[model samples]
Every structure is written in C-alpha cells, then in structure tokens.
Target: MITRETAGELLARIPVSVPDQPEGESPTAVKASPFTGAERRVMGILTVPKWQQGMDQGVLPRAYQDILDVVRDAPGPVRAKQIAPRIGLPAETSKIEGVRSKLKRLVERGWLDEGTPGLFTPSHAWTANSAKSP
Candidate 1:
C-alpha cells in the first residue's frame, strides 16, 4: 500500500548515477560526458539553435506559449504541481496531466529542456534567442 507521497519520498532517497564510463576514465571520476570528438558535433546538430525562426515569437500557439511563459519565469527547475496554476487550464484536477503532456511535446520539439528527470527548464536555445529580440 504505497501511496504516491510515500513512493516519491522513497524514490528521492535513491542516488542517481550513470552506469559506465566512456573509455579510460576512472569509475569514480564522473565521466559526465566530456562530449569529445563526433559526440559534440552530433549533439550540436540535435540541439535546436537559437537562430532558428519562429522561436522568438514562440513556436506554437496560445497554450504552448502560456506554458513556456511559466517555465521562462521560473527561477529554477520547477515541478509540474508548481506549474499547474499558471497554465491557463480549466481549473480541474485533470488539467495537470494536460499541462505535463504539453511540456513533453515542447521538449520533443526542442523548445524545452528536461534538465533533471521530471524537472524542466527553458532550452538554452530558446533563452539565447529570446534575449536577441526587442
């Protein structure tokens, strides 16, 4: 009978770590992805560059912009519960998941970054480009 609250607490106690290292690095040294060679090049390609069009105006329509606005203003990575109130949803419990779903879509499209597992932040690309706008 593990309620969500208890499960979350237990999960929090567990330490997070990557399984293995890249090449010659010591196990305890925290490889943490040096992003050497082609790895860096490929990752750069995958990331949406700030210069890409439409991002300044915000890529998607109203709701997506609403959610992005919340993330943009967050001082740090924020939990979904913290985001619900500002999402412009219909003030129903079910709206939380809807908000989460929109966030996921934004992540996929390179508009957001999942900075830590469930936590989110505006993608570097988005913030960088946003600064260039008037």
Candidate 2:
C-alpha cells in the first residue's frame, strides 16, 4: 500500500496536454440552429396539440397518426388491446398498457375522447371538423 504522499508524487509525474486554439476561434462561438431551413415544427410525442377546427393531422408524428387512423376506421370506441394488433404491436399486457397511456395522453390533448373507461375514440370536435373539410 502506497502512502498518500507517495501517491501524490506519482500523480504529479503524469503529463497533461491542453489543446491550443487558433487566434480567431472562440470557445463559446454560437452554433447554427439544428432546425435551420426546416419548414415543419418539431414537437415531442407528449406535446400533441389540442384538437381544433382546420387542424391538419400532418402535425402529428407517424405513430400518433396511425393510432388515430385505426380509431377512425373502427365502428366505435376501441380498447388499447384491440388497437395494439392493428398498429402492428403484439397484444401483450405491457404493450396494451403503453397504448393505453398514449390514448390517455391523446384524450388529455383533445385529440381523442374517453367516453367510458378503457375505450378510446376520436374527439367529437375532431370528427366534426374533419367531416366538414373536403
């Protein structure tokens, strides 16, 4: 076992190299925006906008659009388990729960309606608005 004093001496022998920057470049230079020149807005999965008249479904991500499509094509409100298979997900309990959480989020965002427990359907406002559009 080496003493603390000997350890310090050993560490002091290690050479540390610091990179030298050219005269013009500053360390904190502003970087270009990652979204530069992009036309569409970027949003996280949970940041789905509330349903409104004339809102385009293109604003949503593909996974969300798929969910909405499945629900819209259904005869009535659908359960998460029923949704999982149609969306290409295996009908496992965990997958069902994941779909349920997304459905709940859609309801909270006004994109869907939860008229009764465990059943999800498109919100009335969304369906009505979509029907009026060409």
Candidate 3:
C-alpha cells in the first residue's frame, strides 16, 4: 500500500497540458441575456393568471389555460403525456389521454400549433403577445 508521501510523488510525476488557445485570439466572454428565446417576458409570466381573463373574454374554458401555459414555455413540440404533470395531473395513461383531448381542442381553437403527430407547441400569436413589453 502506498503512503501519502508516495502518492504525492506519483502525482507530481504526472504532466498536465493546458489547452492551446488560438495563436492571436484573446478569450472573449459571451454576455448572457436575462431572457432566452423560450422565456416569456417577466410581466407576461407574472400575468399568466391575468391573461386568463383575456381567454375568458375569448370564450375559452378556464381548464385549458394551464395546458396553454405549459405549451407556451416549451422549446419545441410536446406530447400530452409530457404536459400532464406540469398541470398537476398524474402521469397515468388516463391522465395523458385526457390531456391529449384538451390539446386537440386547443389546436382546433388555434391556441397551439400542430407539429409532428401527437406533438403540440404554442401558437405564434400567443408567443408574440406574451413577449411584448408592458
């Protein structure tokens, strides 16, 4: 068994190589924006519950608002099974099926965009409105 002193010696014998940077290019740091493309405006996220008032004016049922919120935040198309738990439904087959039905209704009503079969995303209008400053 090697003692601590021998372990130190063994480690000291190892050579470490620094990654080479481009010959003349200095390292540049990228600045991070407060919001990524997928992020809704701070006001919009805060007012999602308030947005529901607008939805109510449009005749959409209140139950659909949560599903729409999940779709709006997704980076890409999402399946109902994936959206189930976000709205607090258990991830069971029945729950997923119920979500699927709601998704179809939303799609039909133009709140969501249809991507690949069984996949749904936020509508362009929804994103545009939510991203507006105000």
lDDT of each: 0.68, 0.78, 0.67
Off by over 4 Å in 2: 1-46
TM-score of each: 0.56, 0.65, 0.53
Q: How close is candidate 3 to the true structure, as a TM-score?
A: 0.53
Q: Sort the predicted structures by TM-score, highest score first.
A: 2, 1, 3
Clashes of 1: 0
- Quickly count the clashes in candidate 2: 0
The whole-model C-alpha lDDT of candidate 1 against the native structure comes to 0.68
Q: Quote the lDDT for 128 in model 3.
A: 68
Which of the two, 2 or 3, has more TM-score?
A: 2
Q: List candidate 3 segments past 4 Å from native.
A: 1-59
For model 1, where is the 10-residue window of minimal lDDT? 35-44
RMSD of 1: 14.2
What tens-digit string does per-residue lDDT give for candidate 3 at 1-134?
45767877876787754355555554453333333232233323322222321233133445577888788778888999999999999999999999999888777655777877898988766666666635
Q: For residue 2, give model 3's deviation from the true position in Å.
A: 90
In model 2, the worst 10-residue window by lDDT is 35-44
Error of 2 at 112 (Å): 0.9
Candidate numbers sorted by lDDT from highest down = 2, 1, 3
Tens-digit lDDT track for model 2 on 65-106?
889999999999899999999999999999989888888878
Q: Could you tell me how far off, in angstroms, the CA of residue 22 lies in candidate 3 after the best superposition?
A: 74
